[model samples]
Target: MSTTLSKSYYHATSSVSLSAVTTRDLLDSVAKKTPEKEAYIFPVEKVRLTFEELQRQVCTLGTGLLSIGLKRGDTLGIISSCAPEYIMVQLAAAYIGVVLARFHVGLPNSLLKSALLKSECVALVVGANNDDVYNQLELILPDLKTSHAETLQTDEKSKLQRIITNVEASQGRWKSIYDIMNLCKKDSENGKQRLEETSKMVEFGDPYTIFYTSGSTGPLKGTLHSHMAIQNIYMMCADRYEWTNDDILLSACSSLSHATSEMSHIAPLILGMTSVILSPGAKIHDNVSVIQNEHCTVLFSTYPGLYNLLHHGKINEYDCSSLRYVMTSASTIPTDVIQKVSSIFQAKVLHTYGSSEALFVSGRDITADEKEIIDKVGRPFGHTEVKIVNEYGKIVPINTQGELLIRSNFLFRYYIHDEDKTKQVMSVDGWYTSGDLAKIDRNGYIKIAGRSQDVIMKGGKTMYYASLVESLLSHPNVKAAYIVPVPDEELQEDFCACVSLIGDTSISSDDLKDFYKANIGIPAYIPKYVMVFDDFPEMLTGKMDQKMLTLEVFTRLGLNKEWLVHGRKA
Candidate 1:
């Protein structure tokens, strides 16, 4: 690895070169260069496809899409897990310049309705499972008994024209993906000719797909990433992380719909690395077995994923010596989880920090005593620039806390169809305000304090939940802690600290407060109310469900009435 350690703003430079290329170009190069090389290893499905086969499969699907009136730049949304069908649609959409959009597998009816109208996806593809990915979606589609193609009608007027799915429904309106694949066999010459012509229309700047935010706080917003932007991320990561053909990456804690999995699915094939993907909702034991059986060398996971794996997973009984780096991101990783993963897996714990706006902005591989400073997200990646700006829109000194801003070639182009939201975060000169409070120390290590929204803005004083949560995490009996804002008639907002204990250990709210008073040391870092939770709910991305947890706290405390500034009843 390159020695990126430095002072002065933590901007790491790279000697590697970059280019503007579409995803199709990279796949073509790899397929021609190493046709027989393994591109994917889906151990759960007992499926392995070579580079040449992957190329053919994507191309076939690309032409098939065009045969059904789908044109370049038409949005095709996918609702699936880490299945082969999802990969085919993802790459095929990129091959023909059709914009891809994704929805969570567990999307609710209300959110699905809201997203369908605004997402502008002309077609939607679902997984083989009729109940999981397509349950809520099927409610809006024509009934299963509908016989004619004219019966295809959505509840509202939408761009939706076709509903392609892996499952073959009895109705003709629902187009089967297998039928789309068979289009190549019927008109092989015409399909291939049109595929070539359509491929030429693709450009580096065209929108590749839209990724929805976790929506833990509110409704999901569609973020658009360009073909060139994703390619930049792939090239930069291959160079920065020093990934080789020998590296085997194992996907954990996320589905293909997540941003973290977007490039992981395509870039590994282009970079000549073997990617092993397990099914979504796979148990911890099965995940550990895949690493042992596949001889996996690397893993990308979130905090809860690591914790669940180490705590509940039978690591000592299995052979996990092949692990090289346990890369983590998506949320603040607890130091305990990092130490356990590093110690058990004998791997370097690499901390990463990014958002929907930009992915892979900064990461640090923990070694030696660096585990003690696990809060730092290392330095900025190459070809990326980061700055801290105050509320007045002025740049701040190093080690000062302010909103984080970043400029990179790999950032998402803009929020799709929401120009006001785009202008709110992205500046005219290209610096995207992250809305995250952070700092760069003298040694050039970046530390995330908290999100700007995490602060309690009331009583003319801003109190950050990060400090109090950090204190709560420092408690030996605490496992996870979250400070959620509660409505107040006078202060406008008061907070309640909800904590989950380690294992079966228990502590009263009074005892927890006493421990914080004696050991916390920082008087400003205190909580107004405290409640205990058996465990916090987690989103699909393996991050804590802050929105749902906040609601639970409110419901438990009876938030309808005026609550005091201190000592809230639980």
Candidate 2:
């Protein structure tokens, strides 16, 4: 094992050795080791599966795919919410050696079609909750309603009718998940034979899943991860968090499309832990009940998720003592929120830093000091190396902000079918520039300043929006804060602070300006305008959509199109 510690960089090779294993093999191993252990629980749907049951379902689904003519290495698109079918399809796709491409259920029709076409998906699995999927299918495949084809039946007769109607219109173009399952039952023996042969053919380095980044800034790009990378990263995390078969993990995050949901789906399968998947739109109290009843050991969520739970004002009514760790990421979490979450759940708040391109880079331990827990995103994982470099590609000293570059065995293979775009972010030597401005302290803790694009240039000096937002978040009335740059004829660009306050508490624009001047003490850093709202527009991943917020600010201020720095028109 090799470990390096220096002011300019930090590197550590994992002390825990990992052997080559496919996701299918990993699940089979766990099922053999602990067949009776509960593997998945969906409280809202009233569904439960043991490790053996999960493996059986995955095999059945894999055979069903083979029976329906889905070849190995073919891309399968899953457009669904977090449900048992989603998990089953994900695991089954891996078993059949197909690349499972996740399609955000909330994506627009245009982008959704683009992703499907780009990934060359041969089949799609959709959910039945909302009519959005049917509506999108109408626009994408107009002939779907007119064709005659086999369709799946659901308990809801009306929903099943609508799905059949659409599937008929597709003219045998796509197969419904239910239809495929029925086909699997007809060819169980053949599917089992084929599943065994195909499982042996799958290599550890083959792509397992493709996740598209949340396109808050621009168009979404598809990222591919090998089976080895995904399995090892989650194994490392399971070790880091000391998870075991006895632990029950609960996730209130968004759909399985995002990386956050990977913890709920992938980690449990590898470690033989039980994962509770609450349906989308579940009430905060319902989540609390899952913890209290299921005795969940870990609650994984975004910062806003935990904040809303705490804001519900009934945490005291629920027994959350079983929770040992509250894991959060995807945005900057205020110090006050961290303290309140720890107090409410009686669990340590652990923060993690990762992106779709890079799987799991760094995280803070639950036993970290309060200051480190609140301020830094902790040290890099044992298998990862991190360094901060200036624009000149030179390493920066400790405590100095620069672009963060990471080298890890868990990084994605590349952006699918976009070598030019992939080359822009990743270097030949395996360093993936994160496009995040950050700093490392002498103690090796990493502090993310902000995204490089989020920097506001004022009077020839750099100002970080995250720093300003963090400063304002310290105020008692502020619930969330964001800063964006607006065009200025004289200064080139000016800063605008968008704030959402606590319930029934109002802070005036003048008062905010005064507060900033008193606290920050930087005249140029003070916001030229303060915009308050009941809530900020959020992306699917639960992070504030700064791009949308900026446009809202421009329209509210009645700024001219020419005055906008990015030339965004009204």
For this target, which candidate reaches the highest lDDT against the unseen true structure?
2
lDDT of 1: 0.77
For TM-score, the strongest prediction is 2
Tell me the deviation in Å of residue 124 in model 2. 0.8
Can you give the lDDT of residue 176 in candidate 2? 61
Candidate 1 local lDDT, residue 113: 68
Q: After superposition, how far is residue 475 of candidate 1 from its true place, in Å?
A: 1.8
Please identify model 2 stretches exceeding 4 Å from their true place.
1-4, 149-175, 563-570
Clash counts per candidate, in order, are 0, 5
Model 1, span 62-124: residue lDDT tens: 989999888998999888774778888988999999999988777777777677777787888
| TM-score for all models, in order of appearance | 0.92, 0.93
Candidate 2 displacement at residue 11 in angstroms:
1.1
Worst 10-residue lDDT window for candidate 1 reads 1-10
Give the per-residue lDDT of model 2 (tens digit) for 31-137. 99989888999998899999999988888778888877677898888777748888998999998799999888877778876787678776677665545676686
